[model samples]
Target: MKKLTALALGTVMAVSMTAGVSAATVESKDDLKNATIGVQLGTTGDIEASEYEKDGATVKRYSKGSEAIQALLAGQIDCVIIDSQPAQKFVENADGLKILDEPFVEEEYAICLKKGNDELLDKINGALEELKEDGTVDDIMNNYIGDNIGETPYESPEDVDRSNGTLIMATNAEFEPYEYREGDAIVGIDADIAQAICDKLGYELEIDDMEFDAILAAVQSGKADFGAAGMTVTEDRLESVDFTDTYANASQVIIVKAD
Candidate 1:
């Protein structure tokens, strides 16, 4: 009788443990299915979410990641998708948001130059290669991204064309540590990279700070040489402008205040 009681107790404990583990392992994909998701207009996250979930899941567009986050807080959307770095910053600063464990898509970020501006592109690509070889890219990324740097090394351009000198870069100087205003100077990762590329090619670097949605039009209208506001390469964007080989990879994340 004593042996049978001990065996029953052990069996119950084992079942309870298994049940707990099963509950923990299960994730709610249904929560995202057909749910209204928020994303920034003209962003990779927006493109990917639109493409990947073709079931007509309602997508709420915002002018910026912060706005999307605001919508999420206001219960306007079920989720907000944005780059991991900015997401981290947002999550650290905001409240009640959480990043989903699964990434909706993986993408590379790159500098976008005017289609015919081969000279400037070559110079920028060349500088990028040299930066990779000498670890300059790693150092700069570390300064801005810190310990969040991922596994891939800075990529070098395999081949480049060098025919045109005119280059106009468009960016939104609102995302800090990546692109933002330091007094009158537009400064951050994108700005620094643009400056380096111009210096390498010996071409004048013209920067236009504007709303994020206006970037693609600026590029399409030949009003800007390229768009490089931490731009992500997505198929939807590819239909509008050509992107260079990816230089960086990042994911969308959610930010909420710590519990």
Candidate 2:
């Protein structure tokens, strides 16, 4: 009877251990598989998440990161994926948002110019080189991004002159600090930088405030000379339009409830 009782206890312990392991395995897998990820439309974060999704993953696209973040908090999505800088800002300001330690993708941000606009491209490149050499790029980034997040500084490229002209820029006026409506004016880091480039090139600066997704179509249709509302340079975009040498780098990070 003692031997039979001991065997029964051992079997129970084994079953409990197996069950615990299975539960743990399921939890770990579900963290990734069951998550409904959010990303900004027309952003590399969106494209990357769509490409990287495993089986049972759901991806949601929003006009801006703020909208996606809203969805995340409402439990419409399990996670919000956006550029790290904005993610950090949101985490700092929002009640429930937190950035995950891991990044989904790393991407370079660039100005989108019309295909074959070589002269204007050259002037912009020259100014960019000067900015980098003279620490202007760093200063601008510090003024806007400050110590809030990490970003790579701009680099000058050898092929400076690839296109030319007055670059009409289309941007979404809702991405705070990057591009947003400040009272009556559309403003942000990208706007300031584009204005500076226009001043340097002796070209007229025309800015159009529109929806994020519309900017790309405006550029493609020749309604705008370029587009630069924190635009990410990606292979998919390269097929439709041309991007200058990367002016900055950022990554996609998750915004979740702070634990």
Write one digit per residue (lDDT tens) for candidate 1, span 96-163. Answer: 66766776566688877666667656767787786667775666576677775434333324443434
Model 1 scores a C-alpha lDDT of 0.64
lDDT of each: 0.64, 0.67
Give me the displacement of residue 95 in model 2, in angstroms.
0.5
Candidate 2 C-alpha lDDT tens digits along 81-105: 7778767666665566677677767
Q: Give the TM-score of candidate 1.
A: 0.74
The regions of model 2 sitting more than 4 angstroms off are 1-30, 148-166
Clash totals for all candidate models: 8, 9
Question: In the order shown, what is each candidate's alpha-carbon RMSD?
Answer: 14.6, 15.2
